[model samples]
Target: MAQQVRGVIARAKGEPVRIETITVPDPGPGEAVVKVQACGVCHTDLHYREGGINDEFPFLLGHEAAGVVESVGDGVSEVAPGDFVILNWRAVCGQCRACRRGRSQYCFNTHNARQKMTLADGTELAPALGIGAFAEKTLVAAGQCTKVDPAASPAAAGLLGCGVMAGLGAAINTGGVTRGDSVAVIGCGGVGNAAVVGARLAGAAKIIAVDIDDRKLETARGLGATHSVNSRSTDPVEAVRELTGGFGADVVIDAVGRPETYEQAFYARDLAGTVVLVGVPTPEMRLDLPLLDVFGRGGALKSSWYGDCLPARDFPMLIDLYRQGRLDLDAFVTETIALDEVEKAFERMHHGDVLRSVVVF
Candidate 1:
């Protein structure tokens, strides 16, 4: 039987999201329905509301989430009812070229549920990132539900579904920061701070955090930054070099996603160091750097797509780390709000007032 549930939806671009009664059909083949326990209000949700992602209006907002499996459809063996899981947007298809090559992290064919959740008027809702989880219950591909330790708090664990994972993966997986390496992370937002923690966990000797905001820098320090630079008043590249023995950091991660920040990251690394771009940029954003510089810099320049992570492998391991108190996932949850407070949470996020304001059911 179809279920009626309350969900947050953006009826149009540039409009505020509102709670609506949505109809979620029973899972079809290879799908599962999740009863959401907690969902984080991410910048991506705001982007969806603003039409930054696409013209996909009437969007079902919220993606970063943790939930309990409520039901599973035929052929869905990945998850069963009563299992605690963290929802992910990417559900890798094993037969894809990338997966067949043993790099399932780069799976070219990821999927979501085929059935549409609709409003009472029968208007179709486009799920955000194909895992709209702001609702009381959301339908997703079985592969999207990665089972994890239920002892973890829903609010903290759900964050691994997106930004936190992106940041951590940017450092540990993408940047390949190793023991005793010097690292500089630009933009000390939620993602950037997570990178600081990642570097610390990876045994980085010095973690330099750069940002225009002092508060964010302070947060980064608590997360494991050894040094901080206020980029607004200082040249981040020079500061990083000075902090890293005049050569530059071994790894420079640009988490701001702007061209200027990207250039800063490019010049803030050692000759043989790595530069990882993990920030989300606008379509109109462009970079114009000297071709000579690109050739002269003898390092790897990489873009981290979702931190180049494999959820099934990373999520569980990270949760274990969190449980052991090695990872401070709780620090990322600044506050918790009800579903109706999502708009206000977005405001706080845009104003840089909170790392994350989660919606708890």
Candidate 2:
């Protein structure tokens, strides 16, 4: 039988989300039902509310989630009941060209449950990121559940489902930050701070943080940024160049996703240095850079999708690192909120008042 559960849903564009009695169906073949323990309030949810992602209104918000498998449909051998796991948006289809090429991180075809979770009136709700999890229970493709250390806090572990993973992957996976490298992360939001922490984890000798907010810069410092640049007062590119021996950083990441920040990141790196863009940008945003500079400056210009991560491989390792005190996952959780508080959480996130407001079930 389908389950009736309380869930957060954005009924229309630019409207506040509401808690609705949602219907989650039993898992079908290749799918599993999970009891969500925690779901982080992410900017993406707000974007969905604002119609920024797409016209996929009546969105079931919240994707950064961790939970336990409650049931599985036939042929779902990947995850069984009682398995503690993090929900991932991208469940790679092995036959996709990207997966077949072994770059499953860029999997063209990802999996989601075939069944739809609906409102009381039988209106279908489009799950945010294909893993709507702002409820106590949600259904997902069996492959979307990545088993992790059960001892880890659900609030912390759930973050790997999205933004945090994007930031860390921006530095470690996309930017290829290495030991002794000089890295500069522009924008000290949750994602940018994660980049700072990831740079530290990657053994970066210097991590230069840039942001307009001093509070965010301080947070970045706490997360292992070696130097801070208040971009409001200082020219971030010049400051980064000065911090990195007047030659700019080896790798510069733009987590802000704005063209201005992207331009700063482009010039804030050494010639032939990498620039990883992990920030989500609006469709209307355009990049107008010099073609000559693009050719002359050299190095990789990359955009990270979900941090170019393979959830099954990265989630467990990162969780273990968190458990061992190597990764400070707890630091990212600014507050624990109830599901109903999601709308207010969006307000705080908009004002840069919190790094992450997590919904603890």
Clashes of each: 0, 0
Q: Determine which window of 10 residues in candidate 2 has minimal summed lDDT.
A: 48-57
Q: What tens digits encode model 1's per-residue C-alpha lDDT throughout 11-112?
A: 988888899999999999999999999999988999999999999789999999999999999998888999999999889999999999999999999999
How close is every model to the real structure, measured as TM-score?
0.99, 0.99
Give me candidate 2's TM-score against the actual structure: 0.99
Which candidate leads in lDDT? Answer: 1
- Candidate 2 overall lDDT versus native: 0.94
lDDT of each: 0.95, 0.94
- Model 1 poorest 10 in a row by lDDT: 9-18
- lDDT by residue (128-242, candidate 2, tens digit) is 9999999999999999999998999999999999989999999999999999999999999899999999999999999999999999999999999999999899999989988
Candidate 2, number of clashes: 0
Model 2, residue 248: C-alpha shift (Å): 0.8
